[model samples]
Target: MEPAADASAQSTAERGRLLFHAGLCAGCHTAEDGAPLAGGRPIESPYGTFYASNITPDPEHGIGGWSDEDFVRALSEGVSPDGEHYYPAFPYTAFTKLTREDMLAIKAYIDDVEPVAQPNREHDLVWYADWRWPLGLWKALFFEPGTFQPVPERGDAWNRGAYLSEAAAHCAECHSPRNLFGAIIDDVRYAGADAGVEGGSTPNITPSKDQGIGSWTQDMLAFYLEIGMDPDGDFAGGAMAHVIDVGTGKLSAEDRDAIAEYILSLPPIER
Candidate 1:
């Protein structure tokens, strides 16, 4: 019985590990030369530089003591264990689309990390940013917390791709340009950001020939996800390079194909 239980746990953790990579948890939680998931990565935003928190298994500094409900609430609603609303910088807006099973799987993977006692760095935001209670209002206006629902007429591959891109990889979070309010502009969804993270532009991936990846074949896109080399002989650089290095590059070929399929299906928006 003990051996069987151990196998089951290992299986579950493996599934969770897949989810973690797909979700790019390590890309955000792990800093340069820092302990994995021990946090301290600085995210430069228009407001200020927000630091990622320690997510290791440490009972004192990490989420080691978090219950299932706590984990779910943190991702699904961007709420903290103490009932405070977390800043949107954590990308809970995209994570809200994750299924409960996937969320638990990610937690399972996170559970395997050795506990680290490092403390989290505070965000260097505008003076008014520390008031997290107002974030509830931000959520009310712009946030819609829900799980990914497959489009009925789509094939399994397309649906699977949708889940990976929308819920797991969160492609739109960086690809789409946001309004001054920090909410994504619906009209230009996937139409590229003029000035994105680190003040660099994120490309339009909506299949527009004039501006997006319309000229690229699906195979080309999938291969790019695998090796970071686009069809034009140019290589992806900057933050995208990091994403491919730790996130999408580690995905299964089938998953990469699915992502390519779903991305090509978006409305072609010429930015």
Candidate 2:
């Protein structure tokens, strides 16, 4: 029989699995009609097409050989075990805010998945993009590695919402406009942006009634996350539909409400 600690570890991994879904890792990593986390998804960008890496437990092709420190470094510092800098498309900028405990939980869950013997695909970058040394300069200019800090004045729910939205869910990566360098424009956060998945537009999620989601009640937003059904009788489609299917739709009721509360509390922005 397995030891008590083994059972406890299994329970922690299960919680991690749910958190992984909430974080939308599978949505980005899984290719179209492909095995989950086997990773052949082609993410389009202004620079070129970048493929997501295989994160399964195959030692030769995936993260099976990675230590916990290796995993944390990849997420927190955007550095690989061999000291290669990862491209910004990985969203390590947002992931850098995750706590060590949360990072380990995510790793534990990933370790529990079945190993796939698929090799990682190379990126189809623009001309003269073969070199990775330039990423170091980019990181120096834009990347800020730190954990999420809760405001002492805010209540637990508000802080939790902030952590989940900013760090785990990385909502702004899609919702905010980016500069030429592909860095998010901090000033216009949640105010909507172009260059969404497959060239679609990401709508304003701010609290402006004229342009954003201020017309939505907290319940309405929560319901949308839970089932992708808006108050207007519209259902989410496209990339958002996929997000709802694999990510927000799987969150707990309290978490969905907390996310809505945090988003609705944002100052209105007239995008």
Output the number of the lDDT-best candidate: 1
How far residue 172's Cα lies from its native spot in candidate 2, in Å, is 0.5
Residue lDDT tens for model 2, 1-271: 5799899888788778777987899998999999889999998877788999999888999899999999999989999999999998888898899898889899999998999999999999997666799999999998999999999998888888888898888888888898888788888988888887656889999999899999999999999999999999999999899899999999888888888889999999985
- Which residue pairs overlap in candidate 2's backbone? none
- Report every candidate's CA lDDT: 0.90, 0.89
Write out the backbone clash pairs for model 1: none
lDDT of 1 by residue, 1-271 (tens): 6999999888889878877988999999999999999999998877778899999999999999999999999999999999989988888998999999889989988988899999999888887776777788989999999999998999999999999998888889889999887888989988989777666889999999999999988899999999999999999999999999999999999999999999998989986
Worst 10 residues of 2 by lDDT: 191-200
Cα RMSD to the true fold for all candidates: 1.4, 1.6
Lowest-scoring 10 consecutive residues by lDDT in candidate 1? 125-134
Regions more than 4 Å wrong, model 2 = 1-7
Best by TM-score: 1
Global CA lDDT computed for model 2: 0.89
